[model samples]
Target: MVAQDEALTRRLSRRRLIGTAAMATAGLAVAAACGGKETSSNPGAGRSAGKEEKPRKGGTLIGAQVSDVNMGTGYPFVLLAENPFLNYLPVEPLVRYRNSLEPEMVLAERLEYNADRTKAVITLKPGLTFHNGAPVTPEDYFFGIDLILNPRKYGITGSFQLAGFARFITDMKKVDARTMEFTFDRPRANMTDLFAQLPVVHAASYEDVKNGKAVAGTGPYIFKEWAPGQRLVFTANPNWHLTDREGGPYLDGVEVRFFADQDAMGLAYEAGGLDLILDAPATLAKRYRARTRVGPKRGLVYAGLNVTSPLLRDSRVRRALFLAVDRERFVNELGEGFGTVTVQPWPSSSPAFNPALEASFYDPEKAKQLLKEAGFSQSRPLVIEHRTTQTYVNIASVLKENFEAIGVRAELKGTEATAFLAKLRAREFQDVWVTAHAFSDLTPVTNFQQTFPYQVPNPSFYENPTYLDIIEKLSGIDPLSDEAKRQYERFTQLWLTDPWLLPLQPTVPVALLGAKVRGFDEYFLAPGGSPNFGTIWKAP
Candidate 1:
């Protein structure tokens, strides 16, 4: 295990070096294109050199979102992918990830872990202030941590998402004005990775934030206006600390208009009404290849089986359902071949990702035989109520046909995003639920500890002592260690034998930028593909 850990560290270091070199080379290319001139300090000076453009400061970027930003109770703590602006623009996590997947400090200037990894000291960047003009101190971090760790007291839905920390963090206190300390119940190998997901906010503004009266953060943008179902507006933070580029966060403001769906957003983009489409529909990838920036596979579309349901209680029935679906078809048709068919949730870059299991679970004939062995037949067909949001209704439809082909009757039910999420959180789905989940790329442990479908007391209501033990052990060991890999493989084998969540394919996040949009590629590097408007600028 020690050897494996050392080797993995070496490989990751090499990968980070390569990624850094590539980015440096790209920066040089951009500099050469612009005649090696510095970006203008003047917000209005939009310049170009030899047909290549440089980042300009003054523009109100018009971005489009497929759905309204649902600022649920606890506001930014809910961490919904649909509400990207709330996650990144108005609030910032302590740590963010670069393209190399290495931690980049945001609010935190340094994090030191004890030898046993059971204690941590976090030092905030000095002089950081929230948008409300209050200093960002250790108390603010404690406030946010309290809200997450004691969700019942705050009536929020975030504790379950950070179960690892929620279960292990025994005590937290302020060490100093700019420093905080955390004591864990056990050693946690992925402490920094977990911190990358936690966003800190001003504690004094809790009531205002809860009531939707105001929002404040130490990020690069200040929340200005939110027009319910129509649009939300933000202005650049003039006092932002990061100063990597001249007049950085060059856009003066950003306006995010909410559309009914992707098609409407695409039409708006074509008509020059929008400057950016954060997650363009896969079907439009080819049409906008030149303008689109593709990122690594960060999420997976999976079917969750409710083990409590009689129709799916049998392991044979569940395994049959897994084998009946054609994941490749979902990739080619729904994903437009922009994704890879995967039997497990981990991304290709993850140490837990097993090449042997890639696309190895499809066999219609075997699926039919398994269904027969489980007493399912045309005369006595197994019926399943599959619930999902409209965004994933297409995949659910395909699943219906696939199940029927294997002698199972599948009923499809689609609901609004809010209603679907409510049901999902409540674990009220009858038999099956299909949806896409992120966080599979952060750290292998995150998928099991954070994702709703994979976490303990999961939405599927499927529990095995062995699986629980494996995940518990996984949390305490180095994620890239051979022991961790073996545990993940064991978990995968057990899941296959008694399948609950059927992973279909991993979806690569693709963002389309307008011809004049620049610096938006930085969005792909942040955790969970959250858009970093701070680095994005217009080409004038």
Candidate 2:
């Protein structure tokens, strides 16, 4: 009887122990959920967010790319293609687009114009200094404009738009240390937008821009070293016009490394050696996008037509080619992400994008029918010549496959960069060509308006009368008026519908951020993505 009683007591004891353990686990779960603490599904995720992610403070960033690395003259240099993102960093304009895309002051504290809008007077903030501690002065302004006016001095950057101002620019005189006036050739409603984006040149940096003398600038970082076709290094300029109160750059130093190709750029990113890589095409950029914390942003890619080609002489043929290519698969397969397929020289993300434009869709059957109607048969074989650079070679391959599927043949040709530019500029190429176009953004106008159709017999060989006429009309609109808004929308819609462009991949700035990177959120520019090396700090 005593043994039986002892067994019952032991059974109760065991049940009580299990109940206590269950209560402890339930308490822990409730504490985790209520306190908003994660209970380690991966454990590494919380550790990474806790340990690896650090604020950007001060570090030298190394940017990489596959394009030309020439230090520009502020004229038309290869830098415009590859380095303009960094170039525009320091040259602040009087007015800038705020978070809401409204114009706000940056360098200039205030601005005024004549009664007729022909003359704009600007007042710079006092005490602003260049990287070398030179005070901001108007002479530097004249020097910049002078460089653009003389083709030999600086290449024809804004030559076409400036041509309209040639006679009107009666004076680009500095009235005082902080005051300057621009007397235009004619009354321009959007002149302030034009004025705000005139990249300010530092007088001290002229020697470098002129002869590759030595890189110097007014940017947040100094142009410290450049190993041509290799790497560019920049260190902090403490005197850079930045202040936390002003909502400005937050870190120090920048470095840009050049790679032989996108594959190298990717490898560097994986190795954690590069801070940013700019100018990578669709395939590589998309691959990196999968690993990045944020998705990729769309920028512009120029889908050029060899308009001078006899095959493109028929407007129907040109329009038919637009339908023949499968832009969706090209962007998805080659450029992954939530990519936007655009068909204009302008980036759809730009502030200047007229909201009226709707993107075109890809329809292979429609394209086939269009080609057949244009007299291209399975046997006649209408041949469109496509030139190769690197990115567009994929576009051509897609074209060759898709076009052949649609009863068309494309002759693929490869050319060196210099020859390619020359042939296109001379308008001597046949059928099709594609190139990457990087444009600087102003308030209402897209950069590189130099490509706008110049007058017939024009040296630029860009002859699109409709584009020219629209540019003229839009260029003259008062940005503040509703009527101007209507024109902006109309022209933007015209750009997509006229079938003059074939946009491909969106812009993705490539960079492999190291464990040391910091302060990456401070910089801003018109092109959707670029590095903020000034705000980046290295971890100890």
* Ten contiguous residues minimizing lDDT sum, candidate 1: 28-37
Model 2 agreement with the true structure over 390-494: per-residue lDDT tens digits? 566776677677667766666667776545655544555555566554332333443424332222323223356665665566554443344444544545444
TM-score of each: 0.87, 0.75
Best by lDDT: 1
Per-candidate Cα lDDT values, in order, are: 0.70, 0.50
lDDT of 1 by residue, 247-300 (tens): 477889889998877778778888878787766787765576667666666767
Stretches of candidate 1 off by over 4 Å are 1-50, 155-159, 245-247, 377-390, 524-526
Our model 2 lands, by Cα RMSD against the true structure, at 18.0
**Candidate 1: how large is its RMSD?**
7.7
RMSD, each candidate, Å?
7.7, 18.0
lDDT measured at residue 196 in model 1 versus the true structure, 0 to 100: 74
